[model samples]
Target: MHQQAKLFSLTDKHEQDAILQALSHFVSLRSLADENFECTWHDTFDWRLFAAKQQLTSRPHHQGYVATLIEKGKKVEQASVSGIFPSFANRLPAVSLAEKVQKHTKNRALLPMLTLEGTVRRWEIVDESGQPALELQVLQLTAESARTEQHTSLNTLLQLLPLKKRSNDFSQNFFTIVNGLQSTKSLPVDGLFATGAAATGLVPGDYQPWQPSGLDPQVPATKAIKDMIDHCLSVMQRNQQGIEEMLDVEFLHDYRIALRRIRALMKNFAPWFGSGGQKLEGELQWLGRRTGLVRDMDVFLEKLDILQATLPKELQEKLMPVKVHLWQRRDRGYAMLRRLFSSHRYRNLTAILTDCRLPEQREGDAEPVSIGQAATDTIDTAWQRLRKKGRRLSSRSADRDIHALRIAVKKYRYLVEHLRNLFPREFANLKRFKKIQNSLGRFNDASVQAQALEEMTRRLARSNDPSLLGTFQAIGYIQASLHQQQDEYRQQFFQQWKQLAQHMKRA
Candidate 1:
């Protein structure tokens, strides 16, 4: 058996030193153990991955080719008849499996290289694109022969990769990051939710899918939706003063996120509100679209510098005033947003969110499970599944596993937060999980951002202000700070996971 975790970050030429330093720290930490570690760098058009694999020398390198040749999107499963099939006769089988099993599956064009959640897995590509794109996934696995951290520690560290999006723009794809850990058997929702939560910060939206419709009074999820709406309303009531102090743009964005979650919950589950739900969802949609002006301006400003850099020297000089004009327009839009939020119509909308209620569907015959327990079970089960597949996972397999685990942890976190009192024991652990998840997420975001920044730098090399160089410098500084923080948090999260496991054991 093997146990593993992963860390993701964006590529930056300026922050190259900092990133390498962080990787050095990770390597040093792993070096304390007797197991020899393998470090490799994978670069592609879309992403760059610096991976650390444990006990790679013990395993045989992959040699046999498996192809699910696709002609115009239709899969052809004949291995011998495939023109693209690589010669397997001269190469050795990289795996050791039951002889009977291997013999039975030999004729199958792509034999199962591994299995994850009963899904047959192989390293061969299902299809190929004309573009030069590569997706690299890494799993930090510890074999049975090597000394490894406990499962809790491993998971805590795993959580870091998804959250690193907060501090930087590089590693923003929470879904992709989670998918990379397919071997870890993480909860199905862990990766999905992690991605969603990360997206909420940048985009401020709802939890896309709202399942288990029509309501079951005894279902914890049904109650969770109700409780969450109530909590959002209560939060608004109590924090309205503080909320008013922040930029209306940010407050409204946050409010919209909560409202959408509420709307999605009601829409997904029971029609307890019947006509009222349609009304509420309509209002929520109105709020979301209205707030779009603010968010759009913000996103635009964030990219303005990049756009400026991409212009020609003459165009750059001419665009300086245009930039100021756009900035003024954005500022006016923000002011309008402030007034809109303060209006009677907006207040009424918010008031509805606070006052909305979910009546018990069947007179509440049985008690629903606490939100915390549901989160725990889901996350734990997902992690277990990811761990079981760790040893034999390929790049694609690891991506799917990690993504599923991230989703599991994310949904669980949302639930635990919804009913904090129900699972007091796990409350602290959930907090730790959130922290680590955010760390890894930022790292990944930074990776992508770095790529964007590099492209922009080239495009802007001949442009004005030379002060834009300061922007790149700022980017580098943020990149370094995020890298340092992520490295420390990864270590800390691993430790927290051990404590969380103990708490779970006692429970």
Candidate 2:
């Protein structure tokens, strides 16, 4: 479908009459559809088609059904197809639509959102050159119950489609007239699909990121903490297939973050987790090291192009050996990842995560801590620690000190973002951490990049590749640039830290 097609939502007979009356005075009006038409729309379980602003529908055809994929204004028909054929996107004539489906839904199957029975009347405008140059479709759709003879009305839309590029003038005039009506409102490409979903009580794109569900602060520590980890596990499960198949770099990145979140939560709430925290941390450390290497490689590979672009054109090609080495290492990391994921130990990675209880009857440990109480105490402790670390740093602070401060800021950030819902409104001002995190993050990245450059040079020196000298020069130039960035970033952090410190004292 051509997204250039204009869709205006209409309300009732008054608006329809007004549009028709206006059209008659300007041009000939015709009802292209003299009868009702029915369509069944299909979308992925998460509403991927709707999210992509596309629709796949099977409407009545001659003696059988045909599937038409509708995007902006372009339509492709698969003849003699019946029922909902959404999952087989490759069968569609258009490669773009198939790729879009694959991208949005990944491997998910498409199911029917709803069926619509409606009437569409189209008006065609003929150009002065004796050509039909523009068209308008007045759409009225409804969802009908097959057994009850009942129907639910959907939005009525004025759809204007240009028949040719030469039809711009008429299209403009028609849109102007439609715009004159107070009742008509314009909509986007997914407008029609949304209206149908609304009428049928369907919601799309209902997927989770990495946030925990809302918890009452008074809830038991067991359920609250376990529930948070379970949510992380679910996200990890969702992205594992994508990572294994090398669908994109983001899959492993997300998987690693999920894993890290679990580790952070466990490490932060160690007392509640008891002595097994050590064993759990070690297991996650092994897994984290594996995923971290790949993730770091991914980060560098992404920045490699931007860094290389800074070099003279002649020197740009010289870094090809470094790029290849990173790619090979990244691929091998994923191979290790796949093997780990398939192992029995991977299946039982969370086996020790079970039956964790708050510590028992030692002086202050008798009563189990409430989720609310624990969250408040944890964030306060992290805040104090962050302030203590920041106060110890100076303009001459070592890179390790800066890295330590960054870790402090991150630990506090994670708790504030995740545990704020468990505390009061005082901790709800999330914007406070933005400036601090951004500056700290940039400084850390530049530090890591410089360190990685020196390490890369050492590793490549041992490889004895003939291009060693050029690679060394390229690494040297890049390292100098990175070190400069690190200096600027370090100063920027001091400024951000001062501003945050004053703000906190005032708060």
Candidate 3:
């Protein structure tokens, strides 16, 4: 790769020429185009990776705040793969595409691009061993035209590629790196994030790092199996309503994820169970697919919403009646999902999972396989299926297949977490799957919300519920805004998918 923009000395503690000296090592700044743009690139991947300095600062009614800054850039392309960053250190904040945009807003030259911002979230995960990890979640929430002045203009040509595969490249590469760096270590309290947690002296248990230890063969298979079963049963029994809520809201999209991961562990690590493993594995997959129905429709509705939002306001208003009718139908779909899940068969499935039997071990066959090995195999299998499904869906342009692909990615991710002991390398790969999953997921959300809005509008036009009309108008704006994001990301998504396909082939 050609070297382009140089990394700069982000801290004044270094000196005036410090930025130049620091960046000069990794990049050559003395290139071209010194006139208009602050930075020029000879290479497509122009990102410079850096860890943030820990700074202590005063806050309201508090002594300090811990803050750390990661990668920073100039004139960066909005949706280009150049902006993607791997997961941050155990405790530090990770950078994402949207967060990168926000970081540059303080620069006057980059202000225009910043104003075109989208969604942003900070994700944190802690493991059993007291290790904490941080990840930044980003979504392109801005309008398409907002990016017109940028060096890259892929946003306008979104319709050129099939919608399903956009952003696959970024997702694939991201996961590859994440998996390599996967660790059960807890993030330290040394960075900018530590001050707040330290100030209260109330270290949150969830923020603790994960440390993997303790594997004993003397432990009985029944005991191990019971623990797994109890955990799932507890979740279902305690948060049974929450699980139902997820299904009702099509959150089964995620629940199926949780279910599938557990299933993979139970099936692949057969020694963990002594006998009856195959039967249980088959049943869990069935349940996963059963819940998948709600997930599929949810995605379908979201896509429909995106298509509808592209219409003129007048056309949208005219379609309001039809929108309401569709929602009632969607409700029926949800009802059907609930009925299936509530069946005796489904209950029996969970019961069996609770008491699953692993394959019997032969003489001298002590440990089946390490958790890390198991994780790698499980995720590898999942990734293969996702890619296959993604390809098939892309070729056929089938919405259901697209949804299935998302479901597969999610399930694989859950397995990645469950089997972290078996395979640390798969985390990065899981991250890649998540990126595309999220992109498609956002589209799915917009689609569902749009369907709801359209239906509400139709009902108001016919029955004239003032309250309903007000709700419809409110929802219409929300859906319209979501549509804007969907449209902007659509083009960027395809370019990413193309990249991912190429990368996967190379790998």
Candidate 4:
């Protein structure tokens, strides 16, 4: 694909004219066309397309609207159709692109983010020998908010489109000419879409979670813990809408991850959070349980096709009923989750978490604790606990025992990640912990899948479906396969745990 770059900082018309004049000194320039048009930018409610660095736009065409998908500032795909505003799944040219977008959007509907009516003044550039070189277009956009009817004119955008094959000589000449006219630096805004969104009084990445900055090792433990919780709460709030709307699976995934981190923070540093910590911990646990079923179903549905591919054709055909049952369960689970999010209890929980005050001290709270010291103590304790648990696990250990080891590893890994900035060298053990975590994680997944299949078999039998018999056999085969893989993973887990233990000791 050809490279197309947009410059959105060129606001001065005289400067633009000067740049074009400077370009004419090096190469032949011809004005192509100057026209005005309006286009609406569309994205899911959570801005999925924008998040993926893609833009979906629909503009008036000959007798209808032409929808195009622009990726990384280049028009990668387009389709012409007749509709006031057609769905992306219908207007996209390729099936794969449509499917990809549909998967990202899941059950959410697309909405227009902003509308831009702009005038484009275009010019064609060529070499002295009349060989086509590049196309330069200057666009002046007036963006209007679709929600509030607010209108604002954005900065003029200068776009460079290479007409023919680009070479080093051409690039050097192009930049040399432009660079000589003005000290052209990178644009402040990401692109036209971002500019339009900004002009409409919307921040493109405002909802993105931010990491803690300016942390000091000498900061008090209580202060550090509060900061961490506040950061996680921000992430949770940002993902709340996406999760409630079921815009995409990632929304729920990120929300769960952030929630998990918050729970871990409270558990590991309970003394720092003071007496109210226990109640908050309970509330977090309740929230986690509320969202668990939907996350589990999402995981199962994500791997359904891969699991189906493992079976023979006859067995695969019989697995259709299983897939259907899982999808139905997922839909129900999502609906339940939606209602829970909209509940008064959920709102109360968020309000409490957001406004809760940190305690000055408690009966067992640590006094004069430096953040660095607390982090080290926590990491050491978690590592020792994980090592103690892992040392007891073997191939002959019970499934629950191995699962316990997985949790320990997860806790230790989280500690290392959250406090890695404090101790860079010790945090290098993160790689070792990851190796052990992956092995145990895969084994745990197999165990869970086997149990879920068994439950599905029971449900099918109770329902008395005609395909129950074949489905049961297929489930049995899959469960057996999973058990075998779990056995192999169990062996790998022990070996990795041994290496990790040794690495931790040295560190």
Candidate 5:
């Protein structure tokens, strides 16, 4: 658990020789055996390890090969086998490593991300007692892209590893030597990873959504709306590949969220975009419906265990058929979703969105206003709408009313989130808003689950299966439990609403 410091230098043969020559002036430096090998970094096709800031590399070691997992530039885990390095399938169990890496990778096939062939020059720095105090490794890397077969220099990685007892002394000596050389630049822990990715023309984590910064409050309303739309569209575009490949559930979740936000923007700012707004709104709604089934199934499947655990053993056994049915439906839904994403309509919509531009003005357009004024006005309107809807709900209010309130809260939440950057200091009680939203969300989930149970019971009855009696009884019990839970949330809804209102008033 000793800290390792690394420095990166872009050096040619002459500079490399000069660095070694300068190191001779410091405490005695002894050259260790030089080693050369080809290294390849592997990860899931979704770049899971890279996204998590982890590195898995396989390189020649001793008479065999070693696979090392590095986290934050420190080697945390490693396993080596006494034979040639095999493919990922055979390598995992052969090395006797069976925990974190295995679980994270699961059954996903590992793909080589970056291939680097390099020579590593090792040196041992000794104290006055002629005892090894620190170790230095200089890696001269050349990265090649597996996709294009193009090559680029990844510069050099210079790492200094000090023994635990000599950390402070080594730190002082290391800085002294570095200061003396005055030619090398130190890099952050992940610097080498970024450098390697860049050299191979692969940008890691490039698909992350954009967060707005430095937004001008006095900007035009149309310009502001365009910025918000563009940001949401970018998020959708970023998750497109993940959705198509079905790499993970998050892709569809994020894609749907982005589209929902876009729809919200279009609704709230309809007057700002002229007639184009209506068309964009329709397209966004279409996209949302297309992805809705898969998202709903994903949520239910994720919580299926918890739902089943609420029932007795016999009941649980009867519910297994429903679970199987849900899974089959989800599979079919995902297949359809994949096809939809690959369809011409999706592509054309994406292209149109990418090239979208707000019109200068139209007959029904709102009078030009500053973004700050619009944001303040919108927030006020949304808050008032939510408050009005929430206040109308009583203990005996219909489920539809509660559902309407949930939608209101969602709209207000999205508005605040998207525009919070412009007025950061004003919304000091965002947590209160979030609490109210969550309470309403739970209430809605209870309502939806009850309806789902009813529908499932009817479907099972129509099939006339032998387990129909047990399943029906189980569904009724679950529906009753959900209704009781819903009542609990219902009772707390007013208090939550009041707290949110008080906070908004103060703000």
Candidate 6:
């Protein structure tokens, strides 16, 4: 096996020069070209590449960019791509690197993470026979947060970059010996990513949006509730930048989920939040409604491939009118959302979340209840309600009943999720419940989409646009398709509900 290299961090130029003088004792050293290049690292907002133990860096190469993929801290591959790097993964030239990008960063934009802009003073280590066996690199870098507009000056560091030909000749023991003599600290083989994160003030890639599951069942109800609420709000707050820039639809998706979870916590455990609860709830509701249309359109457009797959190729192509109208509606929704999100009320809401203030205690408040007891009561109550609703659902049930049952299931599911720490058995069955809940949700979505199309057609009719004939045809076709989908999804819901009922009964 080949010996890897050592990268040492040294603050003083004297320390680096000392290491170089020490290196002259063993191997012949020759100066190499000074490298003055800027390298920008790329990864998803969540650090997907780091999660996969990969790091991607791009540097200017001739007329294009050379993207290098480092797998587990070793440079593995490189691709020279023309034009500006894209946010979408597949936009990269079709190659091994792009495939990895697509695999890890599906549906997320590839964002420039950290950048190093400075010079690398280089030296070559010559082995016997006068061939270059290894390379020495002294880096003085200006670290910048590619995620933001800040630059930081990093101290000069020394690194040994082993060449392929020197695999058997030079060894890491020399680095180990040299590192021991000085106060210099050698970076770990995979420490570059961690070092970058520290230098850039970026959190580790292990970050995930907060979930209720992280709450403790043993804590007091009010305290746990506050923590969960604040965490979810933080998740929402973090995504504001991505949403404002319209960087990706997922930013809004995550924002909405966090918002929904916050509402869910309040809805299930309303009494725990003593004061200002109703007002906060009202604002949250208003916020949800404000983004509802755009989110709906986002969902529809995102699932368009599946929707199109259900139709024939000829019909799918002809359904361009539906697509166009949907895009127009989505843009309109975004226009409205942008205004609301940027408004004073939105800023106030954000500040409230950011403040992390404890919900005010009402006058003459009672002692807080333990989360263990509160969670048990809440989970059981919601479960009983769901089962009752489930028993009432049938083939002849009104759409209202089905919708009511769907909402009930959702409320129950959210409770179980939020309090799953107290009840593992219930949480274990969550996947089953989620399957049924999703079916119900899809059924409702199909109904809503069909109805929305009808309303759109009416508006189009009022306009009396001559080009709307194709649109009308497409709308009718889509409605028929949606109705068919509603039936299938409904059947799936009932089937899944039966299985859930059997499991619950046995439990």
Best-fitting candidate, scored by lDDT: 6
TM-score of 1: 0.33
TM-score, one value per model: 0.33, 0.64, 0.41, 0.77, 0.77, 0.90
Question: Which is better, 2 or 3, measured by lDDT?
Answer: 2
List per-prediction Cα lDDT, in the order shown.
0.40, 0.73, 0.43, 0.74, 0.73, 0.78
Query: Which scores higher on lDDT, 1 or 2?
Result: 2
User: 123-211, model 2: which lDDT tens digit per residue?
Assistant: 78776676776677888778753222345887677777778886687668777877777878877665666666666665556545558
Task: Give the TM-score (vs. native) of candidate 5.
Answer: 0.77
Best by TM-score: 6
| Native-referenced Cα lDDT, model 2 | 0.73
- As a whole number from 0 to 100, the lDDT of residue 85 in candidate 3 is 25
The deviation in Å at residue 457 for candidate 2 is: 2.2
lDDT of 5 by residue, 413-494 (tens): 6777778787675455567767877888788878876777778778788887784788777777777888898998988887
Candidate 1 lDDT tens digits, 1-507: 111123332222244234334433322211111222221111111111101110001111234223222222222231322232222211223232212222332211121111111111111111122221122232232212101111110121122222222323222332343434323233322232222223233111222222222333345554666666775555444334323443223344445545545554454343456667787778777866766555555544555566556554444554454346447766776667668768998899877766666654424436445434444554455445433443333333433343344434454555444445554655556766676456434434333344444555565565766756655554444445445654564455445445655655576
Model 3, stretches more than 4 Å misplaced?
1-233, 242-254, 263-286, 295-311, 333-342, 360-373, 376-408, 440-494, 497-507
Q: Candidate 3's residue-wise lDDT over 1-507, tens digit each? A: 211121111122223233234423432223222111111111000112212221211111223222223223222322222222212222113244335433422111211111122222222222223333222121222222222232221110000011123334433343333323222112232321222233223222221111222433344444543454455554444334433544233234335544655765565455555556667777776776666555655555555566567656655554454456556666776677668668998888766665555544423556554333444455666667767766664433544555566566666666555545445555555566567767777765655555556665665668765645444555566667766876654544455666766776776
- TM-score quality measure for candidate 6: 0.90
lDDT of 3 at 451: 59
TM-score of 4: 0.77
Deviation of model 5 at 50, angstroms: 9.9
The parts of candidate 4 lying over 4 Å away from their true place are 1-117, 123-138, 143-151, 158-210, 361-367
Look at candidate 3 and tell me the lDDT of residue 186. Answer: 20
* Model 2 quality (TM-score): 0.64
Better of 1 and 3 by TM-score: 3
Give the candidate order by descending TM-score: 6, 4, 5, 2, 3, 1
Which pairs in model 6 have colliding backbones? Answer: none
